[model samples]
Target chain A: MRRFSAYEWVRTAVTIGIALALGYLVLVFTVDDPNGAFKWFLWGPLSRMRRIVELIDYTIPLIFAGLAVSIVFQAEIFNIGAEGQLFMGAVGATFAALYFPQIPVIHVILVAAFAMLVGGAWASIPAYMKAKWNASELVSSLMMNYVAFFLGLYFINYHMRDLKAGYLVSYKFPETAWLPRILKRYNLHAGVFIAVGFVFLVWFFLYRTRFGYEIRMMGFNKNFAMFSGIKVNNVVLYAQIVSGMVAGLAGAVELMGLYKRFVWQVSPGYGFDGIIVALLARNNPLLVLPAAFLVGYFRTGAYVMSRMTGIAPEIVTTLQAVIILLITAEAFLEFWKRRKIIREAMKAEGGDVQ
Target chain B: MNEIARSILSAEFVYSVIRVSTPLIFAVMGALLSEIAGVINIALEGMMLMAAFWGVIVSAFTGSAWLGMLAGLASAVLLALALAYFHLNLRTNLILAGIALNLFASGATVFLLYLISGDKGSSASIKSYVLPRVDIPLLKDIPFFGDALSGHHILTYLAFAAVVFVQYLIYRTPLGLRLRAVGENPEAAESVGISVRRVRYIALVLSGLMAGFGGVFLSMGYVSWFARDMTSGRGFIALAAQALGGKTAIGGMLGAMLFGLAEALSYTFQAIRIPSEFTNMMPFVFTLIALAVYARSVIARHRKAPSSSQPLEENTET
Candidate 1:
């Protein structure tokens, strides 16, 4: 693990300070009770046991999405088709749940397997283009996300929408297809165990496997990898496929675990949220858990704060952007800090000479 | 088939096509400039969204349309500079930084909108001014052509005029040469005393300014209100349009019009029971296909080159 230096400490503190100040200013200008809103935002999530459970529940999909993103980060390719793949993953699970009624755990497994397949297939669109033509994965993934979004909407509104449900929603999953909640209150699904298992599983695959070595090599330097006799194109394809599966699995697990019916008129943004999680973890699958929890905590607090105080939760997004900017900034405040250090060092040497 | 022909063959359809494409043409031009300068401005969407929000707010508050337009352009240029600062100086990945800025605009716009109007969706509560239209003396007299071209939104006219202006600036100037040289071969340009960073900064700022006009048009001229996510992926579409045009102003305008026509088709066809969702997905799907085809051609051309060693982008796929 990389230890945090003083520079890193200051970087994080400063990033947080800037984000909070911006968020606080928004609150000051709008809400009559800014401090009260801030207090609720900071402490409201932990005020109730139910909220804590929901927060943990919410973190589950983030782990899967983070792992998915981190896997692609291994290849130095920004293939964010996970958003689309997740949408298709849920659709895949819906197909399985709606059609293939089976015995206890087998039904869930069947649904999950189909979801993974769909997700991987969705990711293949961008992966194939990138490998075959060197097309911009960034652009392809972005365009594909909108395609997936509208496709999902069409599927729900046309194929699976319950006509008698009074709104756009799907038929309820059979009890056998449910993810088997671990807690009676809020949400404690078996997906939590799966999430933890995958974290360690990804950690092992990335560090102990030859494929992982190839991915890391390609990411660090593509030409070097090519010179080292690595098949760059194949690695990109395989890495994206696996990553897509994980993202797709996340969508399925979230659907089966959380609600009785599919009511997502707009696609859930867990896929994009995964980018932040992976970034915070520095693209390390092992560290994604903590990063996912951190994001989930803020999201939970936002939800609680909004629920109680009527302040919009969109403020966290601005904070997220600020953090991303600071985190990715290689030379942020570097020159000034280094110059100060050099001056102090020279002064110390002069004192010693005297 | 008959209905489709009737709907599309009208003068009204032509007007709507130009109307729908006005923002896209401006945006595609911006994307073209940035691409030519070797920087793909992915945050065009965010910048547009910011401009749209600011234009509406400033116009509503100050009661001056011109000031609103300036505010819109200023906000967008500022964001562009921020992206340039992070990508060029701070060493952040361009794609990530762009995405982050897009998110920032998406969030901050809504945050500000909610704060100002106590509504998170649209800024309709505030009464905003819209720019005036011009009727060309002879053009307006030419029946069908006049109905299609004359008395359109002020920005709509500026959009087409801006294309001609950009085409001239790109093909006839020293700055254009510097921009192209920097994009084509940064090290060579740097060695030749051309500051690659400065050229790119200029390109990005210009890109910002052009996109800002497109954004302000959306809020002030298209409709006198700002809506959340109103740009609706037009920025991404503009990137695709640029790719389709192979990074040229004229070609990009053609591509934008093509997609704008697709958009107009969706709207016209909605009366015939065609789903809007499917129509909405057309441009994005087209963008993906366009990128693939564009990249394939670029790669094929690269293979035929004498020294087939240069990468398409720095640390991108190559």
Candidate 2:
């Protein structure tokens, strides 16, 4: 390994140390057996291959959602509606799966694609409103979250609710349409490969494509981009639509891969989690893969920790929050303080060369 | 149709408007301050959610609605500080910070709820303190509008008062002038010896206080209990109102009233033949239309004023 800089090591050490410390505090305060909580927080998820597989399963959708969000962020459009877009995607995909129980497997794949398109279309409403009306995407997109939510609830409750389930879940999707598993006797599916492939595709598009360069250019300086003859509004709108579609695909894949039916009335905070994943990755679409996996690992660990030690799973979320806050603020503060320290040290040394 | 029209004018519809408008009144007031200072606060949703969750939790623990309200405000203020610190001090992206905070708020609250109650969905397990209605005896005797408007949670009166207070703060004070100057042109304001950061920080904190009250009112005054994500989408609606209001206090109030009216009408029309889903969507649909209309106006204004690039880009498109 290359020799590490002091600041680099400090940041790494601080991030990991703070995460453990916060997790321990929560466990000690909240759990009946603090030691057990600590042990569980550290190693409970790794105790079983099954649990590791579950984490990977969770990461699949999150990775897609993260890519969706990062795409919009790259274009400098703050699309907060990913969660709503994801839900709409689920709704679209679920309906397709439900309505076409007789269709061949190949046609089922086409239907899933169509569902993602619907998600993009749903997300595009706010995108267009944002581009054309000067409406706040943060607000309009957020409002769409509720609209999508209640709309889903309405469908589950009225249009597609499964009576046998005794809860507000949709009717079972055809087994033929289920996403095929990639591994033997594991919950992990082909979705993981698809999600990984997408990350690479996004990386290529962002770094190698002319349109991607223009999008980044616009995000950096809208005036400069406009001056250089990039179609700023069109790029923004299209980015949002694509982002929404990606999020929607995440939902479709998630429903097909896991649940036999659509049951969620609201998100389990997946869309919102995508935002954090994107942020932690610094809005790089390809990096979102690892970011999403890390988040998924923590979420699974948190759930496991909750069960093992009777601590709330929320402590995991708190730890995540603190981590993101620290990371986002980390480099800037270090840069400023380091600059000051170096200035003082140079003055003391009479400006001698190293 | 005639009978429906008659029922629409009934007192129950009017009361529904008042009830729905209560939290929104505080939300609009909160959003107005932030918009004036040019801080786009998506965290209002998260703030209100935290406040509502903690308001009920504290009230259940302490058995005092007053304490709950105080807790609500405290929670929101802390969140406000985080947003302000990140946006101003670290000079991070405001919207990204907002998204992070909102997710933290939602997940953190739910996690805490499960810890406290062993339940994930609602806070009904706690016997929280609920705010008492203030029956203004003399005002109740004044007839017609008096009794209809008088006996409400004290926050209702405070919300209306905040409208006037925020208006004065925006228009009548030197601080307000400096705040507006900072929001309109940060570089120009900096040239004149004003700290853009300080103005934004103040606006965010004040916005926090307003949203905090909105949270308190939801748990302590209106519903007397908190549910998971109870503030729902009201904060976003308030943001919409800020846009629809043209960033003016009066415009905000008017926009809030219109949204409030849509929400109230949805409840009323729920009894009618209209599908509840479609009716429930009216407020948001109207907000979308309002935003489109607002955009059209901004484009029109840009066409009229060819010299102004700032207004065309920042205020008109967000």
Best by DockQ: 1
Q: For residues A1-354, what per-residue lDDT tens digits would candidate 1 score against the true structure?
A: 245566766776787677778777878877899998988777877888898888889899999999999999878889987888898899878878888967798999999999999999999889998889888788898888999889878877888878998988888888888998787766778999999999999888787899988888898899999999999999989889989999999988988988756778776888888998898888888889998998888788888888888877888888888888888788987986798799989999999999
User: What is candidate 1's lDDT per residue for B106-222, written digit by digit as tens?
Assistant: 988987888789999899998988888888899999988988888899999999998998888888899988888887888899999998888989999999998899999999999
lDDT of each: 0.86, 0.80
True contacts kept of each: 0.72, 0.44
Q: List, residue by residue over B9-66, the lDDT tens digit for candidate 2.
A: 7766666677788788788888888878778777888898889989999888988888
Q: What shift in Å separates residue A68 of candidate 2 from its native position after superposition?
A: 0.5
Alpha carbon lDDT at A118, candidate 1: 91
Backbone clash pairs for candidate 2 read A134-B317
TM-scores of all predicted structures: 0.94, 0.92
Model 2's CAPRI class is medium
On lDDT, the leading prediction is 1
